[model samples]
Target: MDEHKSLADNMDEFRKLIQDLKSMSITMVDEDQAVILLNSLPKSYANFIDTLKYSRQTLKLEEIKSAINAKNIENKASGKSDADGLMVRGRSDKRQWKRNGNGLGLRTRD
Candidate 1:
């Protein structure tokens, strides 16, 4: 898995790899597939992987895939994914009300 690529891209690659293996008559258990996917994640996903890996319940490939997809959505929404070129953060501060040429205070609030 490439850390430089987005989670979606990595997941796609993983799916392709699994497809190729299936074509070659390679078979793996669900647990093994989940483990492989978790292991293939980037270092940024270490915490997520550990959380899933150490869970008490048996691992399911579909669940792992769902979690990855959810995480990808979250990262993209927060501008934290590798695929995002820019990150926007909200800032809140107080500033003195200044009058402009129009004789009105130039202040905007949310």
Candidate 2:
């Protein structure tokens, strides 16, 4: 029927419109824009960035492990034990903190 054909045509057009809209909506950020966004962050975030930079260059395995242990112990003391019931776990251990990138921090695994 003509009605069925028209409906299919309309649906195809709608799908194409959606695809176009999605493609148009996403915009890539240039390096300068990224820098500006980073600059606009809070002082604490800036300090964190500095810490990360310093840590990447100067932190040793012992220092990173110590920090991870300290954070884990603190979390346990605060009653936030991880899945393996571990308070302090290391990178090469069975009960390790789920690492995000190369940062030294603790995160709960649910």
Candidate 3:
């Protein structure tokens, strides 16, 4: 094949293949189901998806799941939160953290 196809073109071809699969008697697809599936991904899974896409490395579903799970555990252990920057706890009245690494504002719970 002399013609080179871009990532977007290959993705379109893949989409067409999936759509064609929907026409088969045994296969079906629902946009609502797809949206729900995508929305249900954990933060780490979403991160993993981006990493996988960018790295262009082939990996199994199990491998991706394990990686995401490990990352989630690590984040939980570090007192870091899935929330946006500057995680605030029940005490907003508490003084702001210092720039120094003393307490580090890293308040992980056992």
Which candidate has the highest TM-score of all?
1
**Model 2 misses residue 83 by how many Å?**
4.9
C-alpha RMSD values across all candidates: 9.6, 24.4, 15.8
- Winner on lDDT between 1 and 3 is 1
How many clashes (backbone N, Cα, C below 3 Å) per candidate? 0, 0, 0
Off by over 4 Å in 1: 82-110
Candidate rank order under TM-score: 1, 3, 2
TM-score of each: 0.70, 0.25, 0.34
Q: Determine which window of 10 residues in candidate 3 has minimal summed lDDT.
A: 1-10
Q: Identify the leading candidate in terms of lDDT.
A: 1
Order of quality (lDDT): 1, 3, 2
Q: Comparing 2 and 3 by TM-score, which wins? A: 3
Report the C-alpha displacement of residue 52, candidate 3, in angstroms.
2.8
Local accuracy of candidate 1 as per-residue lDDT tens digits, 1-110: 98887677888999999999999999989889999999998877888889988974799999999998888878878878644444587766655677789999987543
Model 3 lDDT per residue over 56-106, tens place? 444444454455457656767997444325446695454544444674564
The 10-residue segment of model 1 with minimum total lDDT is 82-91
